[model samples]
Target: MNLHSTPPRSGAVLAALAGAQFTVMLATSIVNVALPQIRVGVGLSDGGTTWVVNAYGLAFGALLLAGGRAADLLGRRRVLMAGLGLFAVASLTAGLAGSSDVLIAARAAQGVGAAAIAPAALALAMGLFPSGAGRGRALGVWGAVSGAGGAGGVLLGGVLTQAWGWPWIFHSVAFGTVLVLAAVAALIPRASSAEGGKFDLLGTVTITVSLTCLVWGLTTARGSGWTDPGVLGALLGSTVLLGAFVVIERRRSDALVPPRLFRTGRVAAGNLLMALLGSVWIALFFFLPLYQQQVLGMGPLATGAGQLPLAAANMLGASLAPRVSRRIGDSATVIAALLTTAAGMLWLARISADGSYVGHVLGPSILIGLGLSTAFVQLTALAVGGVPPQDAGLAGGLVNTTRQVGGAIGLAALATLAGTVTTHAAVTRTPQLEAVTAGYRAAFTVSAAVLTAAALLALLLTRRSGWQRTVATAPARRSAEPRASAVS
Candidate 1:
């Protein structure tokens, strides 16, 4: 309520923002754990079942930037609140749905709401906190959600699906949305729309079409083939659309994604790392649940509980990352984090149907969670730290854009890998549970390899002479004046 306070009630705003983020994340995991029930309930074949997840992901990934720009045009608080409202409506629709088509449509709506909310929430945080330890700490907490909230969802979803039913996942979302909506309403400050610029309708349409086509093609290519006409056409269309987007933006005086930001080595490298690391992050969170339920024969509640350690460790790692960066520099900290995460993924690949949770799952979960949190915090800091105030929303959008897009691509690729492995294992035995376990292991191996490559890339990103300072100190300095005003 006190607008003149030096801190600008950031803690309250963050709590509200994080609540929104947590609910969305919770929905994602809860639904994933209940996928089997939904598949059967809706009579979906294997190919059709994947759309349950992809529908949301495609919509969310495609529209993220447009959402951010919407925030600047519409007012961050307004767009965020609207997003929560839409999310609540979608949750209700999803909960009450009687068919797969309805469910997928509801999920797509949920994704659209998430696309609107996520960037606005993040941009508001940056706006409220600006520079220094305050912003770093805030981003650190946000980074932990990428791990902690994910872990919690697994546990919660498992219990809901096991004890109640699959529909309970949507029910849970509805309840959480009500709470988040109220909290955001009460806690978030009024934000004035900073719009005088024109919206890039063309860019938005092209990018959305491009990403949808690309992800759709990739997801389908697993069941079909790379040479499949639909896949080839989609891929080719995406490439062309992306090229057109580039050309359009270049011609525009105020483009959706300014080419100037790419000139900053830190921004470019951070976006790349966010995308690459997102691949590993998505695979670990998505598949690990399936691995536990399908291969390890764990019940939903037990599977969810099993992931708590990793979630807790992710929060711990986020808390520690800033200090690590302060001491060793961002480059070294990122390298160390990436390597640590890769090692954890490699260990995860050692899991078998016969393996014990303590011996196989626990340690790797902790390691991967820690690694992801550390890298995510650094990447976020690097992306939004320095730049003119006017470009903050765009910068934040780009950071998240890379992440969501990366996640879609990662899921598709990992799913394909897992499917191939499952098929190979089925060759040895019928398509039984044990065969599925082998496929899960193969997917884990690929996940490990992806993380290893990400680690190497993070090393390269940070090792550039100017990149380290950009990651560590520049954003804090760049936003100092505006932050001081916003806070004061």
Candidate 2:
């Protein structure tokens, strides 16, 4: 808890770190409910409007690895402050942007800042609380903030847009960024970077472009036909770039993501699980709001407000995760959390157009919420648990990159599937509302299936090679293993 043997302000340091995470996440999702006003103000076409969201996502997702590595080579604390400064500037620019393109560019700039901020912030937090109950509690707080940020964004988006205007959304984020910057500068201590090595510029460029292409292709595929020439070209280009990146990294002594990082099964497995969780997580956020507004005929504000239950439950579950992990081993905790969330998704799949929010949404939200945070907390620990200190920032970046990429890809696939289902239903002369509801049901059903599969994989992956070693506080692990014993 002390951050060091002599830190006098542990709470302040943690708060500063959490604020950084929350602000970046808030900036990401805060644009959702304000899109209508944003579109009108910027004179955006429907396609252009979607790009507002996609631009931020693209830049943020694609450059995350580079950002993470920057932290490693340049120092976590240094990169964090730099990122926050950029974020504040970008947010202010976005608030004052006069044209659609300018706004989009500003958002992309903000994404770049967020990419740097998120990984550095997490790495700093993990470094602060090295082990034991303190580490577990810190992760719990981190996960809870991560889970709540999106929901809070939606709620605030509506509130600000209605009470003030769309520009206020960006302004508010800018204000938050400044405040977090001050807190972090004052509270957090300086940390060392990787001792020596040139940054992997080649690997960075190739992987960044590869990810950008991949995410763009997926986003485009969801809107335009997958067979569209541009989409196909983007996908093909991404694959080629990715292959080249792999070959390049293997040759480089100073790789952006070293091949040896995956030597330990824990890092590999943790990332895979995070990807799976991210897929379901994206689908839930994307579909749930639309379900409330489109199917239930609620307004934007109402839809935003509806998410409160889920947000609250998610934070509570995050708070509870460490305690549960204390009782059950880390792997078991992940398995249980996945299964619990899967059950919630299945319950949600039973939704009807005629159903009320209480029956169709509220119950499932609570159940899913309980599972998501726990899984996220455990997966973070598993991914970075034993990574060498020099590679901690890179490890953080890699884990986050997988989650973002997985979410983008998964949302595209699920959305495509749902669109197909709705079209087919309409062809059969189904009611509009019913068809939409059925499509949502299909997405949730498939999500539940995916989560169940992930749970089984987590069990299998950990059983053969113990995962307890990766956890922060592996009290549930016995026989006085070194990693298990070191924490307590």
TM-scores of all predicted structures: 0.94, 0.95
Model 1 stretches astray by more than 4 angstroms: 1-8, 428-434, 463-465, 470-479, 484-488
- Check candidate 1 and list the clashing pairs: 155-304, 385-475, 386-475
**Judged by TM-score, which candidate is best?**
2
Candidate 2 segments exceeding 4 Å error: 1-5, 191-194, 474-488
Candidate 1, residue 441: Cα displacement in angstroms equals: 2.7
lDDT by residue for model 1 (143-192), tens: 88767777888888888889989888888888888898898888765644
lDDT (Cα atoms) of all candidates against the true structure: 0.79, 0.86
- For candidate 1, the per-residue lDDT at 250 reads 89
Model 2 C-alpha lDDT per residue in residues 1-488, reported as the tens digit of each score: 12454456766878888999998878867888788899999899988888888888889999999998988788787889999999999999999999999999999999999999998888887776666777789899988998889778888887888889999999999999999999988876554323456899999999999999999999889889799999999999999999999899989999999977777789999999899999989778888878887899877678778889988988999998888888877888999999999999999999998988987899999999989988999999888876766677888899989989999988999999999999999999999999999999999999999999999999898976567655578454322323211111
RMSD of each: 2.3, 3.3
Q: What is the lDDT of residue 333 in candidate 2?
A: 92
